[model samples]
Target: MSMDELKRRLGQVSDLNAAAGLLSWDQETQMPPEGARVRGLQMATLEGLTHELFTAPRTAELLDAAGTPAGETDAAVVRVARRDFEKATRLPTEFVEEAARARNEAHHAWLDARERSHFATFAPHLGKMIDLARRRADLLGYEDHPYNALLDEYEPGMRSGQVRAVFADLRDRTLPLLRRVTAAGNAADYGVLTRPFSPEAQKAFAWRVAGEAFGLGPAFSRQDESAHPFQTNFSREDVRITTRVEAYWPACLFGTWHETGHAMYERGVAPRWERTPVSAGASLGVHESQSRLFENLLARSRPFWERYLPALAKVAPEVTAGLDADTIYRAVNRVQPSLIRVEADEVTYNFHVMLRFELELALLEGTLRVAELPEAWNAKMHDYLGLTPPDDARGVLQDIHWSAGLIGYFPTYTLGNLLSVQLLEAARRDPEIAAGIERAEYAPLLAWLAEQVHSHGRSLTPAELTERATGRALSADPYVAYLHAKYEDIYGLKAEG
Candidate 1:
């Protein structure tokens, strides 16, 4: 088959996958509870069709014929398409449909269980999801660990052992810092942030931050509400993000910024790669870097609030009564151990990720059972953060990842946190990017990212992209150093050796 024909075929499959994504997005954002059953079937049918189309014998023939790199873009397309084809062919279409249905059912069960703070309601569904995950790992095949097979699904080249090593380094560097910060007590007046902020005012402020502050172009992107804050885009021209707004101030504000980072990355991908296998993020880890960068490094910075807090006060004057940029900055960065991962302080966030990664490894390895997940979760929370969740909702059911069949995905979050600082440090070395950040004019910084990171899409692996952009391979040093500097100054603690 010719390259043109191959592109057309692959584009069709991509379209079907995007359609499935739209359905899933709607189910989460707009669909009523009664629609869950039909929505599950709809999603399953779309996924099964996409799987069959991509894994057909014809795709293999075309992938083989589309040999050697014609150019950089074609090379990426062929390379990514070949990898995807091999992976997809390993699983049967029935398994694809079954997994989709299972995920949908499990998501609903998790929602109900979490609402009631009942683990028993969700346990059976979790067990089913775990079984499916194991089956997927077996199908994908792995050398050293079954979790490695699942990890490669999200991170491409990453393995379980590498994630373990990185987490070990992070734990070593962070625990003492956490202890110091905790002993010092609340460094900032976080009570100012807990004041009742109306949802309407919060929505307006979040939109302003996402649209004006973050440069999520209004023409192509939009914001909505969901049970869990998320970003989804069918194409570069139509990106959508959602954030859950509550009485809390930080929920909507930072959540919108986080999703904006994800959407902006989607929007920044080169238009030429649209509708192709390589058009999306290079990997989930790289994608998470954008979100964590915007949410923590940028949104929580003193400079960010200096520019935006005045505008925010205009929107929600009640909450900003005694609050200033400095107070808000310190409040947002306050080092308090929290039950919810999404609301965790920057200093303690990775401990949450680390806990989840370990539990996921155990679950995949059959060392941990779904029935015992609540007890295990509470134990880890106490061990890592020194607090126990009062209920299962705050504990095992806090996140939607396990319910959605997103196994082996937690590590990418910490990986993203690490990469976020590395990328920011590298960008600071460039005078133009530094000036843009200093002036709160983010275009230069965004452009640098577009050119250096986003445009390449899957043209390079995550490690290769890190090296290309940062002048070194991935490491925990940049992230650790960043945390130590930021937290020590905030808490007035002595510098680390």
Candidate 2:
């Protein structure tokens, strides 16, 4: 099999994947309640077909025959295909189909269970998904634990032990910071965000900021409001993103910017490799780095608010009627425990992931029963955040990830935050990035990321990509340093105990 044949096969697989993704997106966003059954069938068929196509024995043989490491072809293409093939073939076809079907059904079921505020209603489905996920991990094989297998799926070289080390450092440094922020009290008022800002105005304002501050031009991207904010790209030229607006909050603004960060990375992928494995994000962690960088580093920066506040004031006076830029900046960055993971403060967001990671690990290891999840979740939230949710809606059922069988996905969010600061540190040395942020010009930073992170796609490993971009391995130093700097500035207290 030639390189061209390998490319052709991968392209076909990409198309099937895009179709499945679109169907899933539609079911979540726009499909009618009655359409779920049909949507499930459609998703199942697409999943099965995609699995068959990608995992066909011949596809692996062709990928292996494509080229040599030293000289036969572009190493990126062969390397990506071979790597993906190895992982894809590890799980059986039956498990893949069941997992996909279960995910689609679980997503729909979760919507209802969330509305009713009941985790018990969703427990059985979640249990099955967990069982399947454990089987998947066993199939994938791991050195330390089954969770490591799932972790490798998202972060390639990352292992469960590494995440534990990083999460521990984060928890130790962060809890005290949280306590201080709470003890000192919120330095800025968030009343500006609580005013009745219409959803329509918020959407328009979010788009402007996404385009002007994030360089998410519509030619390469489209944004729509959804139950959540997410970025999905099929090709560099045709990226799709969704953001939700809160009728009484400013979180949507930051959320849009976060999703835009993801869109920007997708749009920045090297066009020549579009429709192939090498065209996608290097890894979930690296991908999160782009989103977190924009959401927390650039979008939440004081300078960013300096330029964006005035424009926002014009559209929604409530946001600026009583608040100054410092107040708005402080408000958005306030460190406090929150019920929703997506709305968590930057300083404490990892705590949410840490909580979930602990729970999911227990579930997978068979130490935690599905039926006991709500009690366990409430206890953990109280133990970790010192605040307990009043209902499952705000607790175990808050996120759609678990219902969709995503056990190992939580750590990527924290990893992304860590990488975001690390990359920003690298970008800060360029001078232009700071000047542009001061002027509310994101082109320089976006262009820099494109050259350094997005363009390489999966051509590089997550570690290689981080090193090439930030000149270092993944570490907690940047994230911890960033928290210390930002919180101390906002709360006017040393971030030390």
Candidate 3:
């Protein structure tokens, strides 16, 4: 029961977990329809084995004996390992296997349901997923709201009430801003984006931007296509991301940058902590901050398009024929209500996240039933965005999170959006970082994040990391201000008080 033995045991568990992640990455990206059954069993077995190994009695004994470590890195390793071990030990192996199997099956069911535009086809599977989530929260033990337990899994120490408060403030400010933009009536020419750009050209352009513009290392990182854009890593040296290209101009470009943001953080983690528990991003919220920062603040910036539009024009000359950087920036930033969350413009995207958070909370609390979700979702969309999806594919079934049992995770998208601006503000205060960004040299900015955010990994909580890096706790003010200034300039609307 020594520290060395504990590290060895945990490394094996990490390997198994990584193997399972690889299986999932393939399931979404490359697996055939017939492979679903065997993939489900394979994933379930791997998850069960990893859970058992981590929650074993000897692992507990070693954790107790290790107690604490003198070095900062060792202490972080022990702390994160202890937290994960305690959580894992609370769930039975049977529950672990069942959840894995259900998630796998539900994912396939969702795909089929989405294809057919049928909510009923996915309703039963969704009901089982909801039940599984509630059971998990119960097993984890919550003080006030069961949803808090699930929320804590992704964002440690964040509560449902905290998310509600933040969302409420954001919603109030956003509604008026959205209304103003709508009244302006397409001041920016977005017609250029809708022009036919072949998928082949789109993929090549997206890859170039991801590599050259985003600085995702070609030697260690790669981008592929998937049903949904996501990033996964076996190690920092072997990071992989997938982005979909489906005629929408910004989907492939910004999607690639978003996932690259995730991968770049992984690639930038301290090499010393590789294969250890603390080697990933500090938390899901922090992780999303990187993606949102890159996707919106950088990729969508006028300056970025100024530099990259020529390269893009070479690939999609028809689309970029009359488009300049200013036009492209305003077009991409155009505030239009949309059915798809991923395609929603920055100003309206969090409304999409907020809607999902509310629905998921109600579902977990048993106030909402699975059969009623599609209707509920449509109502909320209309309430928030003044648009209703014509089918389940564009409505309730668009996202893959629920099928994968990722309840209580949507709020982090907004949290990340808020934190992205705060983090950027802090980084910009550093003259060196500011100049680097102005000059389109991202190394300084990336290096600063590595030192301040990425390198620490799970060694610090999100609040602590924010406070240490940004000199304040998380806030919605920066994000709101960013939206107002950027949108007002684009749409030529008067600023709100």
Model 2, span 1-497: residue lDDT tens: 47778788889999999888788767656788999887887888888899899999879878778756564236778788888888888877777888888887888778889999988789889998899889898888888789999988888899888899999989998888788878988687766657888888888888888887777887777777666567777677878888787755656887888888888888888887778888888888998999888888887888888888899889988668977788889887877788889988887799899999999899999999999999999998899889899999989898888887888999998899898888888887988887886776878888898999988888889999888888899888988988888888889996465
lDDT (10s digit) by residue, model 1, range 40-152: 99999999999999999999888889996678888889999999998999999999999999999999999999999999999999999999999999999998988988999
How high is the CA lDDT of each candidate model?
Answer: 0.90, 0.84, 0.89
Following a full C-alpha superposition, what root-mean-square deviation does model 2 have from the true structure?
1.6
The parts of candidate 1 lying over 4 Å away from their true place are: none
True-vs-predicted CA distance for residue 28, candidate 3, Å:
1.3
| Of candidates 3 and 2, the better by TM-score | 3
Q: How close is candidate 2 to the true structure, as a TM-score?
A: 0.97
Cα error of candidate 2 at position 319, Å: 2.3
Which 10-residue span in candidate 2 carries the lowest summed lDDT? Answer: 66-75
Estimate, for each residue in 414-445, the C-alpha lDDT of model 3 and write its tens digit.
89999999999999999998987776667788
User: How many angstroms is residue 322 displaced in model 3 relative to the true structure, after the best TM-score fit?
Assistant: 1.7
Descending-lDDT candidate ranking: 1, 3, 2
Q: TM-score of each candidate?
A: 0.99, 0.97, 0.98
